[model samples]
Target: MKNQKAVLVILLSNVFIAFLGIGLIIPVMPSFMNIMHLSGATMGYLVAMFAVAQLVMSPFAGRWVDRFGRKKIIILGLFLFGVSELIFGLGESVPVLYLSRILGGFSAAFIMPGVTAYVADITSLKDRPKAMGYVSAAISTGFIIGPGIGGFIGEYGVRLPFFFAAGIAFAACILSAFILKEPLSKEKLAELANNQAQSNFFYDLKKSLRPLYFIAFLIVFVLAFGLSAYETVFSLFSDHKFGFTPKDIAGIITISSIFGVIFQLFLFGKLIDLLGEKKLIQLCLIVGAVSAFLSAVISGYFAVLAVTCFVFLAFDLLRPALTTFLSKAAGEEQGFVAGMNSTYTSLGNIVGPAIGGILFDVNIHYPYLFSGVVIIVGLLITVIWKEKQFSQSLAK
Candidate 1:
């Protein structure tokens, strides 16, 4: 039991470090834009580049987690994360920035699946949800805390936060290499090797189109899309519209994350039990869509904070609700399902920020209003989704 608890700690730490790398650069993006004399479109593309890299790397990374073992893959991912942060900090050229984002995305693709599969490999079924919640919190809280750190760090030097991020990521990578162990037994590794056809990314991507999974995957995509649209341009938007600085953006995001953490810890499982994943998903979409639209019109920093907190709250709930829904359906095919989940998420991340950035270039408020429209489309899909019979079919 002690060993099990220790392993969970390592897994959560790995998850947190990976996401921290993502949040570390967000608040400082406006600074990067100014330094490069770039536009909102470029900022959006920069964010998309990471997703593009993750999209490209996820399939191979999924395969490697099984073939190479989880511990090794995580170390490789952390090493890449540290290097990516270093590049983004020091590199002056626009192309170099893109390269850093892509590398960072590759690190995310590698780390998430490795950590997730490792958690499942070690935890008992009864304790899985609790363990998974901690992992999810680590993921969300890491990203939330990152912007605050970056924002404050940016006060020192716009580029300093990245260096700090790199140093921290490297430390984690070293710790992981020395401390983490493979969770899977040798017999299980051999079993997974022989069953590659079942867990392969290509196979899962192809199967993701089944009516039941397709609707759920669509929800995931829309959630990613809407959230990215709101977030990628947020610092830029607040900077332009409200004349807010990196410090302000950091504080707002920090407060928003607190609300999300509250919901995630105290309310998440109870809501799942009471309302079920499907109903909770639909409720979150409504809140998300409303908040997205509200953000467009809200004045004053505090008002914006309130709306942003609700937006964060909706998305925070939406992610886990959908994850639970998918996990139950995944059954023996968790590996494949995870890859497909990342694929859909990456596709949404790639498109949303690209489009949101373009729209922001045209008009600062368009992205928020546009994000609302996109999420409403998702809510409509949930409204029409009729999965009761399909779920029963799987039972038989």
Candidate 2:
């Protein structure tokens, strides 16, 4: 295979398995928590721990990717992920599950940024969005398959899903060891090394704390807040509102994943190509806001499922487009820009489930309403930013 195609395959496969590992447990988490007598706050903490570890380790992981190689970092991530899954499957207690989540977070931290950087390294600026769209498709495809299978297995036992995750991770490790390869030119590595040696981490951290960072951070917060609520509590809502079970919820999610993949593969790339990233981002945010609001109002499981599919489609499209936009915004500083974006995303993941859990503690509807409001706010900001950028470009 050509190097670029091979890289794409490897990265796409990496996200597929990684997310499959995560999704394998989704259908069982709430029930398992109930069986273990865990509270909403505890669930929130367990989920947040995973994101927090990713937040802490992402920068270092990105640096390691640049220093050593993408192949090495990805292999390391797979190992951690496999180990975490194996430990979690032992099913001791809530505390053990939390510890496993922390371990998985570090694994995700190592793998995700490295894979993204590898994609950026391989694809030209023009094709990057499309390449990223492919990655999104892979992830959703995994979600479609993983949760569908997991939901059935979870009916028998929750621990079985985690065991499945461990097996997948182990297989992924073997596949990656044989298949993944580095593509960075020697000149690129030397330049990266010299820059890293001369760069001050404090300076970079301070810079990432600026207004742009805040804007991007809030955007991710809005996106993740909506998503986490929908993912974590929507099944419960469907059960209450329409008498759906875990299998039914899994079916809805599987259908949603199909929409997600279709939009990401077919629509997202073309929309970005035609409208450009800034305008496409505005469109996605607006669509997300509308879909999420509608999802909250819908009562029937099928109706809710249909509307929620649109929400996932918009979100899946926007993520890669937004990542490319943020990369361009940073200009010549891909590492810092990517690292900052990943950090903010991790922050959102940390905040998202906790906030959702709190609202779920009140009324499930509260989380959806809050998420819709945030999505609208995010859309407005992106629209304004797009107009400003357009004016600047026209003047130029």
Candidate 3:
């Protein structure tokens, strides 16, 4: 394969492994909590705690990825992820499981930004949306296979899937050490260093403080928020709202993952190019808000599944475009931009479920309604933020 293609494969490999770990846990989380005798609120706490850790570390990790290098951070993240998986696999109780997720969240703080930063390093501006689409596709593929494997293994034992997940991370770490090279070289390093000396970190930092990045930041936050909110309470919703079994919930997610894969791989690239990133984002948020609201009203498993799948389709379509737009707006500071965005996303994760839990306490449908409102805010932001105008300025 060519150099760019090779880079693409390695980055995608990294993303697939990273998400596999997540997929391994997700299918079993509700069941696992039950076996350990945890309450619904405690389960929500478990999910929020992880996001809290990620929010705390994201900015620092992102800055380091920019200043030091993507290679080291990627390696470091993989190692931590491997360790976290092992901890999860060995855990005999809820506290141990909580501890493991904390470690996993920290690992993600490095891994996610590191992977995207590396992709940004290698891909050209023109090809970036497509490259990011590939990354999203890799995530979808991982979710497809990982959950299937996890759901199968979950029948035997939940812990088994975690062990398998750790092994995948270890294999990815080995590949990273051997197969991937620093895409940015010595000349780029010198340029970075010279530029770093003259560049005002504070001034540049101040620029990212504008309303545009803030709005973009909020968009990601709401995306994460809406998703996490639903995910935290979904199993309960499946049981109480529709009288659906856990297996049925898994099937719903599986079907949605199929749609997500198709959207990301087949439609995402074209949508971004055709509509531009800003328009696509606006469209996605509007569709997502409607879907979430509709999902809350639906009672049958099939109706719920179809609505959720449609929502995920829009989401998968939006992701690459959003990432590309955010990266472009970050100016020369990819790491900082990625980090701040990730942090806001983490904050959404932190708040979304907490709010969902509260709403779930009152009424199951309320969480979805609240989620729709959050996405509405995201939609408004996308409209107001002029991504094309921003990119043209960068070109000048």
Candidate 4:
């Protein structure tokens, strides 16, 4: 138990750092765009490329996590993540930047599922809500801090933050390779490996489409889609609209994320038990849809900040609630479900950014307005989403 807890702590740190690396790019995006002389359409493609790569890698990553063991996969993810950041920092051409995003996407595929499955392997179903709450909190904390630091670092040089992120991630990768032990024993690992050894990719996708899990997965996709659409050009939007600098963009995101962390750390687990994942997800979608629309029309800095807060908070809570629901229902197939989760998320991310980016170039507010409509669709779907198996599967 002690060992598992310790391992969970390290896993939490890994997630935090990975997300921090992601957030670090946010504040520097406008500068990077200017530096590269890129258009909004190109930026959209760059962001979409990440999801495109992740969508391709998720099935293989999931199977590998189940087969090769979590420790090995995460170490590889960390190393790749470092290299991706390095390339992004140094690259002068658009194609080179695309390559970096693709590599980053692959690293994310490895890390997210491996870490999620490892947690599931160690925690009881009853304890999973608390466990996932902590994991979600770490992710939120990174969102809170990373941009703030990145904005500050960008004042020095836009590329400096990426290099800094790369160095830290490489160090983390080295530490993980040496210290992180595989939680699953060899026999368990072998069983997991064989379970996926000969499985066809299309068959696995078909399996995930079972009525039991399909609607929940759809909601996951919509959640990612709406949020990514809203966020892909958030810094650019703020810069164009209010003449906000990187620091200003970072401040709003960082402050709003702190609220999310507070909720995740203190309120999330209780809310899961109180509202159940279904009601909470519904409530959050409503908030997200409304706030997303308001974001398009908001007139002032504080107003944008306020609306952004609600948007971020809704998403922050929504993901964990949905994850808790799915974890309860996944039974012995945690790795498979985790992969599917990532796959769905990547799918949403892929389409959202491509459209959102084009819309951003056409009009600054179009993406946010589009995001509201997309989330409204997700909210409406919840009315018909039904899952009877989840109630009986877990006592909690």
Specify the highest-TM-score model's number.
4
lDDT for each of the candidates?
Answer: 0.83, 0.76, 0.79, 0.89
Q: What's the ranking of the predictions by lDDT, best on top?
A: 4, 1, 3, 2
- Model 3 residue 4 lDDT score: 80
Off by over 4 Å in 2: 185-187, 209-214, 329-332, 386-396
User: In lDDT terms, how accurate is model 1?
Assistant: 0.83
Q: Write the per-residue lDDT of candidate 3 for residues 203-312, one digit (tens) a residue.
A: 54475567656666767887998878877887777766776654676677778878988878777778877987777888888888999889788877778889988787
| Highest lDDT against the true fold, candidate | 4
What TM-score against the true fold does each predicted structure earn? 0.95, 0.91, 0.92, 0.97
Better candidate number, 1 or 2, judged by TM-score: 1
Instruction: Give the distance in Å from residue 8's predicted Cα in candidate 4 to where it truly belongs.
Output: 1.4
Candidate 4 yields a Cα-based lDDT of: 0.89
The 10 consecutive residues of candidate 4 with the worst lDDT sum are 387-396
lDDT of 2 by residue, 1-396 (tens): 376786798789989998887777777776776678876656767778888988888777767777777778888998899989988889579778888988888898887777777777778777778888888788888888888988999999878898889888988889888887676767877778777786665666677766555456567666766676556666656665676777887888889989889888888878876997767777888888888778767777678778978887888888887776665555445566666666777777788777777777788687677777878878877654645654343233
| Model 1 lDDT per residue over 1-396, tens place | 998898788778877876776677778888878998998898899889988998888877777777668888889989999999999899999999999999988888888778877776776554555566677778789878898888878888989988988988899999988898887777877777678855556675778887757889898899889889889889898989999888888888888888888888878888877886778889999999999999999988999999999998898888877766665666655555666777788889999999999999999999999999999999998876876744552353
Compared with the true structure, what per-residue lDDT tens digits does model 4 show for residues 94-175? 8899999999999988998988888888899888988888888888888888999899999999999899889889988998
lDDT of 4 at 133: 84
